[model samples]
Target: MMFQLQIARIATAPLPVWIIWGLGLVTALLLFLSVLLHELGHSLVALHEGVKVRSITLCLFGGIAQTERDCPTAMASLRVAAAGPLVSLILSGLLLGFFPTTKSIHPLLGNLFGQLGALNLVLALFNLLPGLPLDGGLIIKALVWKITGSQRRGIQVANTTGRILSLTSIFAGIWLFLRGGGLSSLWLVMLGCFGLGATRNQSQILALQQVLRDLQVADAVNRRFRVLEDDQPLRRLSQIRLSSTADQRPANWVLVCRAGRWIGYLDDQPLRDLPVQQWDCQVVANHVRSLDELSCISDRAPLWQAVRALEHAHDGRLLVKNAAGIPCGTLDRCDLGEAVLHKLGVALPETFLAASRRQNAYPFGLALSQVVDSMTATDLTEDSV
Candidate 1:
């Protein structure tokens, strides 16, 4: 059975699918708005610091503020991060004040606004926890940087704090589940899981940044890649496998090229799901993910910045462009990993087999575990301390 259905079955009965979906949509929309306001707070502060706000995206996790440049000082970074939660808190307070002793407004709307206000309050409070990727975490990191005179040490400390918070939340969530609470308990567990994953990702990115401080995109790009025409049939490319024998398959995936320009990407998953006979009838253009909406990085962009962009975009791959806005190469997470490892003077294995395995086992997960473990390793790492 699908995970969605399994979760639904575990939830309360008498909750019809349409109603549940409606409520979910409403909640998502509300959360999106709240996150937007929060990110806007950050963006506004970033603008004041002469930092450019690139864009904002609202996803299942929350909203993110994409900035064109990093803040020049620890104080600026702290303020930029703190601005979001501060806005949330202020908005919550305003809502609470407006609804104080309310008896005139409809009960349903009042309840909704009250819940919204409460959610904002929770958002503010939760974000205040000292950890990386959180406003409070950045604030604490800034303070640590100020004292230690080391940005790396400050990030390490903040990330460690984040992992501890994540673990505590997970434990608390499990306890809540054991107590026979409903969906709210399950949601707590999921939230904790999400927080853990996000915190770990943040730490991994930081580690890579530290390792590849001066590296650029030009250092790790696969310049020679095949670009396919939109009208091409998948059968032709599938026959000519570029990789080894083990990787040979129907070439349903292709990079869309038009008028000497890289336009988009096309995958064969949807076509493969259908009957084999229907494959010839489908066009590759139909499956394309538009390049206009996808993230592309300049060839001269720093490796660390490119990695951050990939993480923020959550896309495994990005098209590398030259000065003339033409596609020059492709850069993915693996390329970034290899570059970092190479720069660190890690030995390259002789055989292709060993190299592939080593590259695949990049220390992203272990690095995160270490970051978290470091928090408990010292007495000063405790939250109370």
Candidate 2:
């Protein structure tokens, strides 16, 4: 273990290692720096458009610039999204111009500069492709959004186009592999698969954006989570869980109430970690994800609004309150994602199916109805703290 730790330290050392490093370490560093610069362009433009740039990440394929808020207008989005590619194109031009002068310095330097120029050009042009998860896709999405005034429709169009192109690339990769193009062909296959997987989520996003805009949080509120007093014993809660139906996705967290006031939740982990003898003495309030730590949204609010609320929330789960200012339900992140996939014609995972089968004996596999029926609610007091 100590040797492994030392090796990790050596590998992650701040200073670059010459020659010994693989993947053309110096070249890779230059590429990464260039990508970072490109992302900075997008960030600066997003700021100009009044959108807060949250983070810029450079990954294996390229980079992504995430903003705290989505652009309010298609024109604003177009400019922000186009900035990165424009930066790359500029860098490409500069490198190409300097490559000739570098030949007098050293052949190695000239070759390196030439390759950097080529890579930048390729980066700019590749991102111009009309597909999802690409700058070109964003450009197309913004244009379509502007014309139709429906972001969902724009996403659907890009998703469909990306699917066709990704499938074509996959076949092309396979052909190259068969012709002994070898490792490079394998890379193409991998890139195609990555693109395919990434774009698959677009369909769900489109469906969600459509449905959420029309529906309210009240329609999909989950009230099945049990509320427990903060003074309650861990053993008692554990017993309840062990005695309950053998649902694999059984509620792992319990809502905690302190003197009739709603706190956040009591995760079951501490219960299992604590000694059995101390279980009764250790009150839930001692370890809870506090109510103040979570965010609340109106149950009457649209589902898309709740989605936005979750994005701003730290824990990704919101305490859904009714008009009376009573915490009526919990809106979980996973639940929202599941709703989107369901709307996109994706079936629930097998774990959910198995859980439902054991939770209800309803005929015709309508256990979901029984699950809904089983959600018993206890009215919250005025001082539910």
Candidate 3:
């Protein structure tokens, strides 16, 4: 009986499976190929506008064409942004036009062409919505930028509009769900959420870029920091306490030194775990991460460079050194948060200010207070002292 069932399955599966699989693979390939063509349209336009094309990538949803650098002008950006949608629209028109002719050839091929045409049309129209991270949003941004002469102002307007549109879509999705749309409504809601997130994220990225523009990491540096001898007797560590001076806030990091050189750093977490009795028996060198394992950035480097380092680093706090190869200070996301807020001209909220001042709760010192005024716990990590 099992053999009979298996034989039945094999006979039934071969024809339909092969045909469906072949058709499906061809359809998917064509869709991605169309996406690649759309991205190429953008890349070609970018090249025409004197912007260098880095690469064109076909993604699950669509495609992305990256430029080596931002377009030099608003008009240029607008042209580049519009190019992909224009290509999709053009492809849709061609497919629809040719679909009628394909009907005589084969039913499967005809249906496939019809579907592709419809999808391309939808893709073009959907992407035309004025939301950030979308082609239409870039067009809107370019238009706004051209009129206002400020790229930041353009991003603000486009992102605000995008958020509003996303909310509308979300509400519409909820309405659809109430009307028993089921999976379709859920899909709409997901798209709305994705759009909303993308818009906000792109806006924040623009803001961060502008705020950190031409700014070096040195501007946020606090010259007053503490260093410890790695070979020093651990019993003396109890005497070392954070000092709040008028000139500087407080030292966040205690750099470990060996032979008069900064070799590593003592982690405050492990030290706090030990009893007072064991302090004398342990050496400071044994409790610290070696310099080789530490992430270091130059004081002269840009704030963005430090940010990139911190993003990929195991520790949030970086060992910042001066041109003289001496440890000047530590750079953390907190400092960046403070600087970003200062750059954006936003006043620190009272509640946030109060929380950052709680030194005992966090790893670092009072300098963190300045940043806590502007940044949240998500922006900075409490991995170091």
Candidate 2, residues 270-356, lDDT tens digits: the string is 877888898888777787886655588898986666665765776556778889777788766556545545555666775664544
Candidate 1's C-alpha runs over 4 A off are: 1-31, 213-348, 353-385
lDDT (Cα, tens digit) per residue for candidate 1, span 1-385? 1223433644545657675566556655776788789989999999999888889976543467878655667788788888999999998887677654552454334444566677789888878887767777888887887687666677778888888888888888889889887667877777678778978887665654555546788887765346677776655344434353453222222568867677787654655576656557766666667765656798888665665566555345567888887777877655666677777776455354234433433333224223323332221122221
- Tell me the whole-model lDDT of each prediction, alpha carbons only: 0.65, 0.69, 0.69
Worst lDDT window (10 residues) for model 1? 376-385
Indicate whether candidate 1 or candidate 3 has the larger lDDT.
3
Clashing residue pairs in candidate 1 are 131-137, 238-251
Per-prediction TM-score, please? 0.52, 0.59, 0.60
Q: Please, what's the RMSD in Å of model 3?
A: 11.1
lDDT for model 1, on a 0 to 1 scale? 0.65
Q: Kindly report which residue stretches of model 3 are placed more than 4 angstroms away from their true locations once superposed.
A: 1-15, 210-219, 225-385
